[model samples]
Target: MLPTNSCSSPTMSSPELKKVTVSLPKRLDRSSERWHHYLTIDLIWYVLGYTLFHPWTSWILVLCLRAQYTKYHAPEMKIAMAWAMLMSAIGIFHIFSERLAFGSPREVDLSDEVIVITGGVDGLGGLLAETYGMRNANVAVLDTKRVDDEEAEEKGVLYYQCDVSDAKQVEAVAAEIVEDLGPPTILINNAGIAHTKSILDTTAEEVEQTFRTNTLSHFTTLRIFLPYMLREGRGTIVTVSSVLGHLGAANLSAYSASKAALLALHHSLRAELAQNPAAQEIKTILVTPGQMSTKMFVGVTTPSNFLAPVISPAEIAKSLIRMIEKGDSGELAVPLYAQYIQILGALPVGMQAIIRRWSGVDTAIAKAGLVKKDTSEKQ
Candidate 1:
């Protein structure tokens, strides 16, 4: 509504600007901060991790008690020591698990890698492309949304106008990217479109388009650009999926079904890369983010804001960049809840139904009046 309903001329004329729209609440100034604004499960968990769960911080509690000359057998001293030991054990186990699973981090020099990001003109993809551009990395963006030369130059990212769902267009753009930016070593398959309509009411064309863009596009980009990555000997592929992929919702049948395919694709892609000896240094990252505060889900609203807060595109972009640059393979689930959504499937059928209702996972679209008779793609 910020762009569509705004009376200001600047907001009305530039529709592309709508892609940057965020959730209602933003980072509030201290003077404007209210108690409710500071309260969220994420915030509480973050504070607890640093102060209570942190190994180093928990040890400080033991040190303070000892400095007071309290006996080791004292209840306070014993409690502190036990807590610190538990935290340390968990930390060591986490490190060991990561090493056992991913082996070692691959070296990455941004200047040497040619990066290609699909749907890089807007949302999380756009932020990542711009960040790499500023770092002087060779970056190429393929998107249906066209960016003029002036704007592209200003942002320092090469813009190629192409619909990623079409394999031919992607192949053509892949050739240009190789010529212009060298062999693409980093491919971010992020192009996606959502069609929110009931399964019964949705048409064949709409379903096919959604799958082509959201699911098959990953296959298209990987097939076209992955060879260069294999030849380069070192590369990173980031697949951006959705949390809804694990838990489908009403009126989002096509969108959820398409995203679900990405989960399978990411796993299959990782497995193939792992088996290839040449892909030892190649890394794959899967990002499954919860509801984002972006224009792509303009009308949608989460039923519980505290439990499932709307993560900003910038936050997810930062995590993606950190993993890609570090040259590590892993799965990223934003806003905490995304990481646990799979647990729902393991629960009893009645329990799963109850939890889904409580979480408002299925009814969010209909409640928000987001379902439409005419389906249109929104990126």
Candidate 2:
């Protein structure tokens, strides 16, 4: 038994927490011989953001020039001043744009919030649920995977074995969650399944099943859980989508299409929520993460590690938790490319084809031998 005065019993002391760990999930692929294997475009962008693009940091160049006794009219000083002003403008624009698009962030207290996550048995969902559960927060996880009572007690989370695809089942589980925990103040619709097959090869049943879990589950949860949020006067809804949704892949047609529907659904949800005065405090977050190092993409390989690096599920979870706790309403697109994928649509067809060919989005699944039998779920 844990000590009565033990402060770290759940989080730090629970060293044997099998599914979720305190540290971030280690990346699977570290086999590259090159020293720059970990040096991704996203990493470079992050460093540049703080050093060069940051308003205050950019102005440091002006300070250095002044200390060197350089005149203001000198070329180096003028260039420095111009760069500083540009950075300042960019910083100001970012703040104003964020405020205008999402309005002000709401207040969120995790302890007071009853958090519910669909497909929280493993993967990104599991990471989210377990993190909050460890903190002694009211966390309920819904998934097809069953967790024994002992395991549930150990993790400090209530596990409900329910098929998220079924509307009736979700409704039934919702009632149980309301009874066990308080009304769910945070809803994470993170359940998804992928059937890696071409359009012609994929069966009708497979297509429906894919949509049922990947897309339709969001509608089911929102219909049931959103009302409670409205009644509670504050809540946060998170929708987990894929970067592949914008760029349809060859073998992953059903999966990509299903995720694509969520993009539209999220926008529609935002519009509806905006019309409701009761939902003024309801914050929405849309996460479109790139290929993550999860069970779903075990065999899949990135075309370029530098440009399209495999992201860890814990990394994605960390970003989501921060946004939800901060009560911000916005989209979280991981990696540098995922955020700007929409630009591909504006490009000329030939140029777009060339880019896609180079990216190898279509051939990755085929190369990985992801046939019809190799279906995987993202929890």
TM-score of each: 0.88, 0.88
Model 1, residue 245: C-alpha shift (Å) = 0.6
Per-residue error (Å), model 1, residue 30: 9.4
* lDDT value, residue 318 of candidate 1: 87
Which residue window of length 10 is worst by lDDT in model 1?
24-33
RMSD of each: 11.1, 9.2
Candidate 1 off by > 4 Å:
1-33, 374-379
Per residue, candidate 1 scores C-alpha lDDT tens digits across 201-316 of 78888889999998888888888888888888989999998998998888888998888989999999888988999999888889999999788787677767788888889989
The number of clashing residue pairs in each candidate reads: 0, 0
Residue pairs of candidate 2 with colliding backbone atoms = none
